[model samples]
Target: MPRSPSLRLSVLPLLVSCLVASGALAREAGDTGLRLLHPFATPTPPGAPNGAAYIDITAGEEDVSLVGASSSVSEVVEIHDMSMEDGVMRMRRLERLDVAAGETLMMRPGGGEHLMLIGLEQSLQVGDRFPITLEFAERDSVTLEVQVREAGEEGQAAGQHGH
Candidate 1:
């Protein structure tokens, strides 16, 4: 039995639509699993050369590594970790920060880890917001709208948690 040309033409559109919709759904589900919680930066003094951003990154079902970050507000952004060596505090650039599956990595000031924004074009003030793109090794990159907070203010206390 030969199929009619009109019937085949109609079926093609239906098949294409189904495939497109399915792909969209899959991406949405996968991307939603990884989330940035309470992203914020502290206010910087006038003419300060550097500042830091803190956030809680919650990983999904699979492990992911934070490879890099970028922002227009600064000339360079780097992941850093603070530690004590011979009773002296030391900060160093980290190549990658790994977030294990079903785990959260907390980046906080005065803590162990944070994102260093170096060579600021302008001083960051309270109530200001900026866009930052976070790159990951095993998942899609996410752009976060980071809000500036008072110096030493914690994001958890300000209730800025988000998915």
Candidate 2:
């Protein structure tokens, strides 16, 4: 069975919190077969990057891998994963993720899969937006401006790319 779109939309903020805290961000890209939902914020002790964007992706009708990511505000951007171990949660770097056609794959916080933006070059204030490029398996790509929100607010849902 498939999950409802609205239900998928609801968890975007919490995922955003996870991303921000972990150092990744996602802006509203309208919605794609694979979309980026929100930029969850992770807790930082001090002297951390300004902010990171979080996202949600719902693959519409094709299979793709979230191969690599790039952003101008940071030095390094890569796909990441946050998983559970014996009821313990942990985050790590992932090379890629497969998005099955018609499946609602979430790249939210606390999940086994996510994105990573390391070493910020700028400060992130509320209501800020930045640009990032996402590359897929078919050699196709798209660019989006990740919006920055408060530590708790969920980012706007991104739209699908192709039908």
**Best candidate according to TM-score:** 1
- The lDDT for every candidate, in the order shown, is 0.75, 0.60
Show where candidate 2 strays beyond 4 Å.
1-46, 49-51, 86-88, 155-163
The most accurate candidate by lDDT is: 1
Off by over 4 Å in 1: 1-29, 155-163
**TM-score for each predicted model, relative to the true structure:** 0.76, 0.63
The CA lDDT at 149 in model 2 is 54
Model 1 Cα lDDT, one tens digit per residue, 1-163: 8878788655654553453344221112133366566677999999999999887887887787999999989999999999999999899999999988889887777769899999999999998788777888886565666778864566446454322
Model 2 deviation from native, Cα RMSD in Å: 11.6
Candidate 1 residue-pair clash tally: 0
